[model samples]
Target: MNHYRQIAPRSKEAGGQLFAQFEGDDTIIVEATPPKWCDRRNRYNFHPSRWLQQQEIRKRYSCGLHFVGDWHTHPEAAPQPSQEDYRNMQDCFNKSIHDLNRFIMIIVGYAEAPEGLHVTLIGQNSVQLMFCENNL
Candidate 1:
């Protein structure tokens, strides 16, 4: 079974701050997209154009790195995956030709103090909390 790297609170904050990061050596590439959402509740947009731009920049910056998976924010306490989120992940997984290890989905919740923000990973059928880290 594959296990996810548990991201620490400080790393989660860093992930939130940078919002995105791409790192790789040769055989494998890792890229993470932090959650970015609109202010409106009903309209949940993940900013695809920005994500595309980030991919392009990564291609230019790193010779081997490529787009892998994405992340988004939920803006709720005790966040739970919504129907739309599930659908989107399904679409993403279906359209992807790479193996499961190459994909990742992260959801961040903007709650309150102490717990402040929480990160979760969306898999094919289940969800799991995740940990993040800074490459540099």
Candidate 2:
């Protein structure tokens, strides 16, 4: 997303949780909590502040906006999840208290691209890249 891109050109990765709400069967992302206090930062790695703050956000919104997924910048032409990325997603799925069956991962490539965004659906039983429609 443009928010990620604005910080991608620099020397480190930028990331945060994606906030959204469900409408019937659809999940519509409406907001995000930018990285506040990242514990680690580098071109290839990022470890954001743990999920503690996420709880505050959920309460602030009265649990209306859920932590649907995460978004980060990748310094490459194509965004691909690293082994660590997969691990993180798995951790998220296991400890999720919202009873989420699926979590999303949005990777934004560094290169200028017509479509720099790549989204993946990481469910309890499957990990798959999802087709996106440009309704944005």
Candidate 3:
């Protein structure tokens, strides 16, 4: 995830879906895809192509990976989800077919982790910030 941070001025916003595998009560994210060519990315925004994303979900699902979340990059030091970000994520939660109650959203900022990262869980009734361990 840190590899996709928009640290350089020329770097555009990049992002993709996150895939994970469930381990007892824990969700271990094993894949954080890089932005696809079909995705629309600028310094301020990342708009992943829904068709491509769905395709990825299907492919990963076949490999036993669960679609758990999405992630993107930002140009700032400490990235925060914009109102649009919240809306898009909520829209995904509402529209997608999934058994999970929520989906994670990760924003990677130009600075280093964990301060540079904005991690949140989006559910039907709530949006909650998540903390990262010191290992980051």
Q: Highest lDDT among the candidates is held by which one?
A: 3
TM-scores, all models, native as reference: 0.47, 0.81, 0.93
Q: How close is candidate 3 to the true structure, as a TM-score?
A: 0.93
In candidate 3, the residue pairs with backbone N, CA or C atoms under 3 Å apart (3 or more residues apart, or in different chains) clash, namely: none
- Candidate 3 residue runs with Cα over 4 Å from true position: 132-136
Candidate 1 residue-wise lDDT, 7-67, digit = tens: 3332222122122333344323244533335212223344345455455545644654444
Cα lDDT of model 3 by residue, 28-112, tens digit: 9999998889888887878889999999999999999999889988898888788998999998999999999899999888888
Per-model tally of clashing residue pairs: 4, 0, 0
- Could you tell me how far off, in angstroms, the CA of residue 50 lies in candidate 2 after the best superposition? 0.3
lDDT of 2 by residue, 8-104 (tens): 4565777878888889988899976666664477777778877655664567469678777888877776666787887788778777777677898
Best by TM-score: 3
Candidate 2 yields a Cα-based lDDT of 0.73
Report, for every candidate in turn, its global Cα lDDT versus the true structure.
Answer: 0.43, 0.73, 0.88
lDDT for 26 (candidate 3): 97
Return the clash pairs for model 1, or none.
6-131, 7-131, 7-132, 35-72
Candidate 2 TM-score, true structure as reference: 0.81
- Candidate 2 deviant stretches above 4 angstroms: 6-10, 60-63, 132-136
